[model samples]
Target chain A: MTPLPRWADVVLLPLLNVVLAFLVGGLIVLAVGQNPLQAVGIMLYGAFGYGSGFGYTLYYTTDFIFAGLAVSLAYHAGLFNIGPEGQAYVGGLGVILLGLALNGAHWAIVFPLMIICGGAFGALWAFVPGYLQAKRGSHVVITTILFNFIATSMMGFLISRVLKPVGVNSDESAPLEAITRVPQLRTFIELFKNSPVNLTFFLAIIALFFIYWLIWRTKFGYAVRALGQNPVAANYAGISNQKMIMIVMAMSGVLAAMVAVNNVGGVQGRLILNFVNGAGFVGIAVAFMGRGHPVGVGLSALLFGILYQGGQELAFQMPGITREMIVTIQALVILFTGAMGDMLRAPLARLLARSSSPTGAK
Target chain B: MESYLVDITLILDSTVRLAVPLILACLAGLYSERAGIVDIGLEGKLLAGAFAAASMSAVTGSAWLGLLAGIGAALMFSGIHGLASINFKGNQTISGVALNFLAAGLTTFLGQSWFKRGGYTPQLSGDQRFNPITLPFAEQLREVPILGQIYFELISGHNIITYFAFIAVPVTAWVLFRTRFGLRLRAVGENPKAIDTAGISVTRLRYQALIITAVLVGIGGAYLSIAQSAGFNNNMSAGRGYIALAALIFAKWRPGPALLVCLMFGFLDAVQFRIQGQVFPIIGEVPVQAIQALPYILTVILLAGFIGRAVAPKASGIPYTKER
Candidate 1:
């Protein structure tokens, strides 16, 4: 089959997939006797209508951007890092420990240390699976899946037994002082009033550009892409596939660790049980929908951010529709964009070819 | 000594009970993976079956009807998986992941909307659940020596599905190794191209394998809600499906070994429950989470070839395409 035009491949195909996902999501709403159009309207208004709502959307978007970039970086290395959830969870330990240790320190001092420590922890968590895959011939997918479960069990123990403050009923660490916590954007900007959007949002934006540069403009990026496309050829070209896999996975873990920085440092101000809350899983859909491109990841992350904030509002407004409807939609997006991605390709290419043949026949 | 014997018996009995769902789902994976389909969505199918069975049993007040509905729900999920992987030639892993999320989201969404109980079906009772059946002379045998107590306490009182789970192992072994269709199915998984060249329909054999997978996994799901817990709760399969998948890998995709691995995992679970908050002779206090995590940790070790190599079917996770 003929390849699709660059524009079609990059933009049109993803847009069609998103549209198909929404159409099916709409059918789900309709199945439950809710008006799909009304649900969409509520979602749009909830996501962007007010200042605080838009702020929440951006807050959620920050998490997705990091998670998406994490998954995308691994995708470029032909690795599926499904343990981002676990990595992020373990990263919370670093963030919390640093925050607690520097409880009276200034936010400016505490924030960067949290990032470094948390990134290190997350990277270490992911590095194990990568190292195993590299040296031991274990498939990263299965090992990563197992790591997620281990993280859950390990984190559950720590939060409940090891870290919980004395006399505290909840399974959480001692909260950081307000001065030491990542300052919310609302403190400086009136538009984001009462929202949790913080400096991490800006960090997320910078990371997106940095990842783009790292993945596309660097020689290491070429090696990674070459490895992904054909490992044997990349090996013949002197790229150590094992070293590349390990480094790329560690980098992906660092990206995933940003979720912890966003949640524990920026919003929660303490380590809590299950705080990642499926954001890492959302990265899988985001990376697939974005086709593993930073620019596309940004757009899809924003789209999911809207769906999340709007879905919350819709659930409150429509008794029939619930928050899980967004999850269903997210699953559909993964299905159409990632799995059955090429189902429409042949027909679309045929149509484009037929339309352009008259002028191109010469 | 008598008290120790009783404790061992009790633990063994719960081990059998806990192993039932894992055994069934592992057998399910055996069939599907043997046909070269990597089904990570087994957890979702189990949850879907649990929800459907609980909802139907609550509404119809018949455990049999609930079982059928549960199987139907799992089959529907398998059909979606088949469509994506077999027909559209999509990424089998991604398709499985999507189906899993779909099952999770749809089950809870519908449960909340339909039952109005925060993603839970109504509590089942009497005919609405598969209650344990006592074997003949179980009461009479309980008063006898160790052998009689073992028969009565350890073997006599489980729901029918538990019995079926044990029975299905030998049946699966026979069906996989002794039948013509079984040979064809294994051939398709090993080398679909060879089967296709020999005039056999690889797709048909795979779909048949998936159908069997759906039935076994559905039964397992139904057993969770109706026999074990008496109703469906959100995410109630609680990673048993994934555990079963791990067991399948641990067994090297063989039916008999799959049963043993599941029982071993189940024993770990029972031991975890028994030892929680308890002190031991050498270990002092054992962390409950450590025991909970043992199965997964072992699976990773096995997969990493630290224990032994686990070689999957050659054609697994690759979609087939006919040569042009």
Candidate 2:
């Protein structure tokens, strides 16, 4: 078997896996007595058929980009930062606190403040587990998983007990002043008319370039990649694995924290419980499907964005294909792209080898 | 003093009840990890088990059938994990995570489709659910003070699943320490090459470990839905599987210590339940969230300093290949 070309490995493989996952999803739909083609049609229409639908898809895409980048950044450092849910949750608190404190401040001032504070909060939340992994010998995966629950309970407490307005629902904070809210995309762009997509989408694109530069261009990036590839060899080359782990994890947390900024400041305009939802977990799959590269992450994030919006449409159009069923489909995608990724790799490699070989010369 | 005694009993009772599921999950992880397989998918298996148990009980009106069905479903998931990690030589963590998503998605989808109550099964009634069992002479023992209170409150009046959970701990400890299979399991975790040299199939050992783990996790999930509550709710495991992971770590991968650690976590949960809304003048009403976060906080603290370096099985999480 021959090795796949870089393009095939990067672009074509994930696309094929996605197709396979969709086929299996179609089978599931059939088992449930629904036409797979009709469902797909509805989903496509729901995700991209209209302007507002496209805007909403892009809005979710913004979230997945932030989260996928977070996971990808950590993956480069040979770490699985599963605590993004916690980090994003804590980051929401930071954004909310800043928004509340600077309630009457200009949008320009508040936005930057939110980014700094939110990033710091998220980084700080992750830093403890990172420090433990680096110095205390605790596995990052275990600590991060535990932190997710802690973060949830902490957010629940804060939203209900401290930030909640009296005589109102205990699960959400009082709305921030309109001055702090980012204008919706529809306000500035005719294409995204009447949708929640906002300026954060532009920020996500900027982040993509920034991460690409950080990971591929710099000496520190080289050191991180080296350590991830071979820690013993990297250590022999005088790289401090401890320092790199800490910095990379903190960076990962910062990216994850941005999701809160997008959701709370841009979309919700208020802090709500579980606003991060399962975006953090979904990010793991995004990074996996994307192959932990900036461009790959961006493309996969868009794919997932479409899936989210389209899944909702499919659920609405077909009662049998419930929202949870969409989750099942998403899970199948993750399974094929992640856990069972190698299922088609060997066969495809052989096929490519056979096609490219000089048969007549041989 | 009398009220304090009653409170202690109440807390102990809740602690025992809560610890049952946690103990089962910890033991499940213990077996798998000991066999050199990292089972982060315990949460998934537990949830699948809970759903199966609840749905089957709701339909068949037999808790035992629900228990068997739960075990079967959990085993199916565990088999997938084994096939992926063992046969495909895939990343164990990724496989585990995928299993979790699959369980979460599948259970809800099936439950919603079948029962139509937003992914919750129909609530089981008396004969279909595991009810608390009163001990022999419990009514007569009420007047016997401390021993009677211990017997009636702490020891007795829990479902049969609780008894199985407690018994399983000792059995697990014995199996891990006393038997030849136990030695092989320990050897497999520490150094699979050594076992391979001894002409044993590492894959089979790992698969057996996973099967045992799944059955235990299944029972844990069944205990949650059928004994703790009458029906299964979506994502009903609610991170207890992770708490069990913390317990496994806190116990330093030993069975006896794992059980004790699970109980300790349960006690923390019971305390959190009792003190959720209480106000204190000096501290200004400890928020329920702080109490809920206590076990995780303590686990982190223990992982960092309190416990001296908890070492996992040496080969755990590394896919063992015959050639490599």
Candidate 3:
């Protein structure tokens, strides 16, 4: 059986998976007593339907976009960058440490530089496991997960002792200077009053286009495709498997770090220990649902953004639904999306079978 | 010397309790992985079991029933992993990760909704919870100089599961070594294609191994809720299942070695707990983070392919296809 056109897979496959996931996963949501339509409606409304919610939703979707690209970058080069949460946290650590050191620098260059540093820091942190996976052939999953625990604990230590935000008991670093804040119309941005939805979202869109271009248009993309399609083949074709592995992981880590940068510079203006909040991990789902493509991952991320928003509305309005339900949906998307390739193969093959075949091949 | 003597015994006793969960889980992993299934969802099953045990024990007021319920829940959850990965050929790691999230969410949701306890389940009474059943009060023998304290602390004051856990370790060894089924399961893991050609049903073996893994993990989960804490909290397994995975590797995937690895891990954990105040006091009262991290660090250092080679089963995570 032949595969779908690579072009159509990029455009339509993720949407189809998501549509199917929602329909199928609806049974699960209904079993839990949530009205799936209303729940989805509430989610959509909460994210983009009304008030400042749309801004807030897009704002976080940017982070999702960042994480999605991060996961996809690794996916391209045949690496599973599972330590995004850890990388993001470590990036946040870098952000606050740098922000503090440069306490009152102008937002233009200083902020952008810090953001780059955030990405660089995340890249470096992920490089540890990436290098290990390439060199020592350690299981990336175990190493990344182990790193998450260490990251959490290390962050806990840093927040409580070294970066303790004065007068606040919560585990967090002190707030960044107003000068360091990402430019945003926090005041009088009609409907969304206090949201930190700023230029970061635009940055995320720019990143998406850049990633899409990188994956499809460049020679590097060919190398990544070569590596991911079959590492052995890629190596046989004169590509450096070790180099690509490390580079792709670093790229994934950079994407993950962008999540931290957005969270600190725009939203929280400080590192919240809870900031990781599984967003980095959820990127795995986004990457799969998006089919390791930038645009698909972006839209899929928006779908989750809607879920997050709607789940909140449902929880608030009905008290029966829980935010955890949204989490379940997120996890379910990954579960179903991972099987997405298999799900399509037989059906697509059957549908597009040759005319000589009786009643279309099954 | 006296303090050292007491601390060592305490650590050993705690080691046994902690070891039960890890041992049972590693055994669970053995069954699945030995059949080339790579049950990464052991952690999820453990969490589901913990939740089921905690909730059921509270409702039924029977620790035994709760244990059974926990096992049933784990089996169901693990079955989902099996069905998705084995039948549908989904990515095992993603499925396992999803199960982990699902377990965390569903447990937390139910725990909060029904129990009104946020992320924790309702607390049970002494009888409802598993407690240490001290050995038949030996009046004179427990008074021996050094051995007495060791015997009392190490062997006595453990719930019934602890003793059963140790027993199961050897039983697992026997099953894997002495039994025909063990050989088949191991053969399937190492070379399922050969096993398939040999006329052994790889499907049946994998299914059976997964079910067995679920039940064992169920016991560990029950131990977590009913025996260890008597209350269910969100993510209470707290990566112990992964530690078991690490132990499985540290033990070279052998039952006896796995058991020793579990005990060593438990001892490390106990030492971490015991050294809460004295060791590097800057990290505050709960020194568990550094201590908890020790196993993972050791795993990386050990399996950085430095000490030895660890090769997974040839077709560990891949779904088998008749055509292929």
The numbered model that scores best in DockQ is: 1
Which parts of model 2 are misplaced by more than 4 Å?
A: A5-7, A355-362, B280-284
Candidate 3 pairs with clashing backbones: A42-A310, A43-A310, A52-A191, A52-A192
lDDT string for model 1 (B1-324, tens) is: 999999999999999999999999999989999999999999999999999999999999999999999999999999989988999899888888888888888998999889989899999999999998999999998999899999899999999999999999999999999999889888888999999999988889899999999999999999999999989998998889889999999999999999999999999999999998898898799999998999999999998898989999889988888999
- Model 2: docking quality category: medium
By TM-score, the candidates rank as: 1, 2, 3
Q: How close to the true structure is residue A275 of candidate 2, measured as C-alpha lDDT?
A: 97
Q: Could you give candidate 1's per-residue lDDT for residues A1-362 as a string of tens digits?
A: 78999988888888898889889989888888879999899999999999899999999999999999999999999998888899999999999998999898999999999999999999998999999999998888888888989999999999999999899998999999999999999999898888899999999999999988988999999999999999999999999999999999999999999999999999999999999999999989999999999889999999999999998899789988889988899899999998888888888899999999999965
Q: Assess each prediction's global lDDT (C-alpha) against the native.
A: 0.93, 0.88, 0.80
Per-candidate clash tally: 0, 0, 4
TM-score of each: 0.98, 0.96, 0.93
Q: Write candidate 2's Cα lDDT for B119-206 as tens digits.
A: 8999888978999999899878987888898888889899999999999998998999999999999999999999999999999999
| Candidate 1 deviation (Cα RMSD) | 1.2
User: RMSD, each candidate, Å?
Assistant: 1.2, 1.8, 2.8
Question: TM-score: which is higher, 1 or 2?
Answer: 1
> In order, what DockQ does each candidate have?
0.81, 0.65, 0.56
Highest lDDT: which candidate? 1
